[model samples]
Target: MAKYKGRILFVLAGALLIIIWDFIYYFVLQYSFNLQVDLLFGTLILFIGYYTGKNYDESNETVSAISKSEEKIKRLNEELHLVLQNITEVVFHTNSKGEFQFLNHSWEELTGYSIKESIHKNALHFISLHERHEFLRVLRRSISEQKEKTKIDFSFQTRSGQFRWGEVNIKLNYDENGELAGTVGTISDITERIHNEEELLEMNETLAIESQKLSVAGQLAAGIAHEVRNPLTSINGFLQLLRDDADEKTREYLEIVFSEIKRIELVLSELLILAKPQSVTYKRINIVETLDHVAKLLNTNAILYNIEIQTAFKQRDLYIRGDENQLKQVFINLVKNAIEAMPHGGNIMIEAGLNEYNKVELSFKDEGIGMKKQILDKLGEPFFTTKTKGTGLGLTICLRILRDHSADISVQSEQGEGTTFSIKFEAAHQQERKKREQTQKVW
Candidate 1:
């Protein structure tokens, strides 16, 4: 409508000018009407109207194109803002001086720092002190190499003053002259991933050490069982025969000898368990029932030692796939250790429940004298024990049994603060289905 109005106004003004000119020529100039002059004047007016209208249409098209482009740019900016606000990772932009220029909503969510307050602050300030040097080195190296993109994993400090693992991917921005202008990057929370990786690496190291111990045990097991046990058994029989005829003083010595022989036999048996693989019956067994039986069996022993044993379970029907006897041994060892730790008679709390992963978790927490870090680290090693009479193989055998049942064991202890042993196993249903799938695949 507006474009047409401009054309209409031009045509009207041209027609009015032609009328005035013709009137002047006929009335004021006192000249007779000339057909050629009127025709030429009318033709000139039409030509001017056509030329002005064409120019107005072209100008209007250019204005419309500019308006559409601006609208497109506005829509795009809105979409970008929405994405940055909703993403889980922190999106950021920094100037060449490493000062923050822009931060998205996730930055506040992750670091507990408001975006408005964080802007213009040095980004390196949020990185852990120990990692800052490495971060700067990486940034400088990227710029020196003229790399457009780079990545680094660092510990990022939050507003609460705790550090979390973050993996940052950076894309360098440059001016037209190729000088560094700033950087755009995203930081993702990798705390869980880093923890899992550390656990896996520690587990691998532990397995390597256990493998070496097992090799040594295997070499010693067969020799000791066959070459030494037979003679010891014969000598034990003789000692018992002689014990009946010995004097009181001699009897005391014989008793000590008998106890030592029994200790040796116990050690030999545990070595066999650790060094050799036994037939395991994998079936769904109620873990609650197993734990209850262990508790009952040890109740008398615990009472004699001036200790009390308590049992608690989140559910009544907790089940797992494992050999009942082997599982019982593991629980018994852990409970007994707890009982022994508290010589002055403290309570041992045995609890079972489902963990976050939906796996069965059984924990034994004891109010007893705890171990130091060095002793705790050496817990599962062969011949490692804190007790005077311990064969040092009991806990190792328990660990081996649990490992065969696909269970994980962890211990926490602080000097004078007591200790807790936690064991995790796959739920019975999950384990059963996993085995069935494996069997089917094998067939």
Candidate 2:
């Protein structure tokens, strides 16, 4: 009876333990506590899980954005390198005190110095010492004014110890707020460009010489033809004399010879001026008197073109020491050019005034077909003419004469507008002119 009573107690205790286990298994282990037996472990695991998931998403997004940014930067760097690769000219940046700050691949290649060597290098070392003060003054002024573009020519010694002429164009570098930053410019290897231009000029000069030679040849041919024709004329006269007594057929042949001889003389006479250039006798003559004379000579043409010819000769006596014939030629050429330019009637303004330097400035402006810039550049070159029937030597000869007389000429022409030629000579007092002439004689 005691054993049965003990077993019954054991069984009741076991049933109570099972009910407690079942109560803890589903709800406590999953929600309140874990199998680790420490209540703190359950709390720690819950906090860690939520935080790790949030951290992982944020990190992944940040990494992806950073990768894209890196790719963009790499592409830009490649583009910059490619653009600067083939340039042979020096491209650089410098500060106010002539310290080099940035230099491109061209600057490195041209100077044979790396960017590291160029940094903090004085630009004065590159530019000439004599022009340094003047040079910097201009640069600073232009920068301070925030001039967008300014071009200046300077001579500099390169890293190779060679002097080079650089035509540098600088623009004021400004920040976002319009404050001056520094100067940025490109240094072109104008050495080759200049050399080629000089070569081209030399070649053009050679062509001019050849053309002059041809002109001489033409003159020689004309002179020889003239002499031959004169003898032939005499021979034809004798033939005509014979023909007077000869048969009809003989007389006809003689008439042909006589006609040919006369035709030859006309062509020869026109070309004789080129063979024997006329020497000028310069004299100090009053120009007003000659201008009066020119008025009468050009009157016919002025009337023919229905052009209004006007003169403004109010000065007492403007004397010039030049050949009368040559000066007349110059005036004639100018007037003719102006008249031709104005096919339709247009006003021609002629003014004689004393320049600021007191030089005798004679201006002839015509409202006519003006010229292009390209044409003006080679204005005095022989054979460059706007006229279809122009010999093209008129302006060339005029320029030569003006230069010989120690005078200067300036011309302004524009397309479809008008052309103006300003002629200047030393308008020193008559006494001063004599003094200069005497000084020249003594020297």
Candidate 3:
């Protein structure tokens, strides 16, 4: 329109110049010119100018409208970019061939793969190898069924060689003609939540075992206590009498009888501990002193086995609210077990420290024979022992005592690598700390 308008204005100016020249020639030089022809020429130039000027104004209005529309689109894209960047869940788009076309900010944060590196990469690259086949199967099923949306849970590998569980929700992207374009999806890292759920399930299983102990305690205690104690007492008394007047051979026999009797007594005592629900006497005791005392008491046994007992008390003045005797017994059993594990003399480390969770942790690690997964799983059960002379009641008692103190215990072992028995107790002042925090919040 501008070009047309410029051409018309030029024509109008030329026509005016020519008409003026024609008048000049006719008046000054007696040159005759056609006046009607000049009028026709001027009129035609005015009409073209008027029409072209109107068209030029319309063209300007059209350009202004298009500029406004482009500005709106620009703003929309900016807003969408902000939303995608700020969202925690990873958002992405992939072609039908499963190659990534777009990935949001969270994708980089979670997978440590920048947007530039991720583009044109296969979407399955983020998924673990074992799960990639399953992912492809799910995608195929969705496509074959013509489903608009599909959801799948799979483990995704990160740039650091760590795997995290991600839940993906995918939808088929289509054009205005309803033909398939590609897939768009969101991925949420559920690794922490998955771990928490698994921990809760394991805790529930442990709690169920504890419940069974309580239930069996009542029923078995009543029958066993009365039936076994009387006869065992009589046998112990008779054996003592016989051992006093016996010769060398007979004395040895009597001594064996006495030892067997004592073993029965020890078993009975452990049963009673489990059978009766006794109130735990809680006291704020220094955990360091308790561990030191237990280690000292077991020092002789450790020395006899040619093992060195090492203490690593990383924190001082650590305290917990628990039954002093029971807690001491727990340490004694754990340390003694560690000593016995090393028949050929190895190091026994008893370490104590405060964990990030504000819990006091004591670990008894033995450089002796370790246990397999099967034995580790059945550790706290009654009558479950790996040692030939082990009563198995020792660990059971330890577990019961720790449970009474509201503590947690975990054991890790690998065959021939050694074992670590970790017991965690809430710090004595932890509750006070929590109360102070809550009060501060209230204030």
Candidate 4:
């Protein structure tokens, strides 16, 4: 009766029992039953049947609830096991003591350990011996600050005792009070990624080496050509003296020898130009004046060949900062090629203007037979030529010079119509020098 839940029902039952028993004993049982002792047997039978039925129902319900709870737990455990088995990389959970408490099947496969072996050892034991010190440093730092998560790249020793790089991500587990409890993490093999990075680094290093080799080859050739100049001058002087002393018949033969030597010297000079590296010597040169001078030199040839040569330039002075000789060479090659292409005295137009970015834009147009796409692609490759008795070095040298100056060039042409060549030089830096009145402007 002291217990509230059971007390109320038990008290009600007792009150009913007393009233019913008295009624049965005094009225029906007392009169009908000749024996007074039959009351105890009737009451005992009713009490036993009622208590037994209630107890049985309550016990059955308790058993059913327990069975359902155990079934749910089993289902969840199986799902977790399947998930752990599917991953390719390793996965594990550990307590603060560094003992493995849980692991995926990958952990066993990667480390060659059965579940029994892994549960006793910490992750530190699985790492490569050489990388242990570094890993220990990272682990200690992570735990000291109570870091909730950590990502680290390190080497791990596999079951076969080979080193493999891994990218590990670990999260700290905490209790309700935010106290550190343990850690759970995933480890991914990054051995291939690391190897690729190293390979790329090696390739870049090789490119630098190739560039240096090309430079050395150029220097050696230039030195050899310079040495030949002295010998070449002596030979030319003797040939001239011999021609002066001889008769016409023998002189003609000497002249031929001299001409051949001169041709050899010219070849030497071309090689020197190719091998000698250019030093950047910038000076302020008027583009209009340079073009005017070049046109005048070629003007005679234009007339001799009955060609129409014309120039259209901007009114204002357009100056640029560049090597005088190299820039002149580029223009001369363009103009000469234009003239050569137009064999039948066609028009050669040279145009110059400034672009929006304050860059100089120059174009050479010629009424000549245009080239095909295949020829255009190989135009700047050394030793490629269509002209008979041509050295084939002119355009190749032009390409190198322009590339060195960081200038731009483009060509447009149509078959049987004409050809046009364009050059664009950035003048923004020149504009800045003009605006700021840089002291180097005079040059």
Q: Highest lDDT among the candidates is held by which one?
A: 1
Model 1, 158-178: lDDT tens digits are 888887999999999888987
User: Candidate 3: lDDT of 13?
Assistant: 70
- Model 2, runs deviating above 4 Å: 1-271, 377-384, 428-443
TM per candidate comes to 0.69, 0.45, 0.60, 0.46
lDDT of 4 at 11: 44
Find the 10 residues in a row with the least total lDDT in model 1. 1-10
Q: Write down the RMSD of all candidates, one decimal each.
A: 7.9, 20.9, 9.8, 12.8
C-alpha-based local distance difference test score of model 2: 0.73
Query: Can you write out model 4's per-residue Cα lDDT over 315-397, one digit (the tens) per residue?
Result: 45877777878888888888888888887887899888897767899899999888988888667654578887565667767
TM-score of 2: 0.45
In order, the Cα lDDT scores of the candidates are 0.89, 0.73, 0.84, 0.77
Off by over 4 Å in 3: 1-58, 61-68, 71-210, 217-219, 239-252, 435-443
| Model 1: lDDT of residue 420 | 95
lDDT of 3 by residue, 21-77 (tens): 667778878866777976787677666766766676677678878999999999999
lDDT order of candidates, top first: 1, 3, 4, 2
Residue 90, model 3, lDDT: 95
Error of 2 at 27 (Å): 99
What is the Cα-based lDDT of residue 133 in candidate 3?
Answer: 88
Compared with the true structure, what per-residue lDDT tens digits does model 2 show for residues 279-305? Answer: 989778777677667766886787788
**TM-score, cand. 3:** 0.60
